[model samples]
Target: MPLNKTLSVLLLSLISGGALAAEAGTAFIALPGKAMLADAVRLAATVTAIDPATRTLTLQGDNGQARQVVAGPEVRNFAQIKVGDRVEVRLLESLSLELKKGGAGVRTRVDSVEAARAEDGSAPAGALARSTTVLADVIKVDAKTHSIELKGVSRKLKLKIDNPEQLKQIQVGDQIKGTYIDALGISVTPQPAK
Candidate 1:
């Protein structure tokens, strides 16, 4: 359910008209690990309306709510969508935490970006993903509250540890690094005739 919520928010923000100008990009960060999590989501909706001239389509969800989305130049077949076609979207996200092994001083963050584009340089049916990793120093820990505070890349914050045992593995001044990945994609297919 959390993944679904995350995916929906990501997909809607990317596919909605508001994101028409958004482009694929990547970013990274380094920080102290307080908590880590990962998950994914897949969803589909039916096309209810389309205006090729405007490069836009309206999708009706299972709940009967209709949302309008604008296709950028990357969509190779914006003209191919039909009223009954189906649009599928998928998103994957992950976060991993680790302790620095025999390392000292600050470490640089890692960032990379990639995009799949059509012959015309459009990103139809492709993916845009961002991965960020950060290394931070643990500042404090509270076993009673199952939480820990950290300072790294930028700023300091406190987070609750889900598993008490995980808290035992980290200590003040220990280097904690975390990597996070998030991606989104969409595809369209014809609806089978009844």
Candidate 2:
């Protein structure tokens, strides 16, 4: 039997609820002893079918790709979906690093996660936020090659400095403070009948 369609549930599965986004492998800001990289992506898929029985779905992408997907148990509130609805996905990623002094002088790390969903259930929406901070000692620096060795909580990391001038501000015995953040968010909205 052909399954009922509400296929954007697949997009819902992809969204996983958290944040806007960042570009891949692109540095947003770079300076001596400091660097930042971040990017974001937003996508919307139009729903073409909603069977309301088997949780099947048909969705069209911006590039005109259409595919079917089965909504698994991980998908919540599928009953709220309908044909002509739109599912949106938002993603964000960021990283920042700096060499500083006057730290505790020991390797350390911190992690955090946050999530939220729509309370009234008018629509399917959720988001998740995650972050981590790491403190490592600058054990070695190679000015010629623009490289540095960092001793972290459990191991060492070798990093190459893209800008030579940025390397000049760093030195051995300094504390390297770094923070990375990522977020994903998803939502569904009804469309006016046309």
By TM-score, the best candidate is: 2
Worst 10 residues of 2 by lDDT: 1-10
True-structure lDDT of candidate 2? 0.71
Candidate 1 similarity to native, TM-score: 0.71
Using Cα atoms with residue i matched to residue i, what is each candidate's TM-score against the true structure? 0.71, 0.80
Q: Write down the lDDT of every candidate, Cα atoms only.
A: 0.65, 0.71
TM-score for model 2?
Answer: 0.80
Candidate 1 residue lDDT tens string, 1-194: 33334334547754563323222323333344344465666666788888888877787765566778766554575666778887777667778778764353574578765555334433235566779887777778789999878786668778777676677777776777878788776667777878
C-alpha positional error of residue 27 in candidate 1 after TM-score superposition, expressed in Å: 24
Candidate 1's C-alpha runs over 4 A off are 1-10, 13-36, 101-104, 118-124
- Model 1 C-alpha lDDT versus the unseen true structure: 0.65
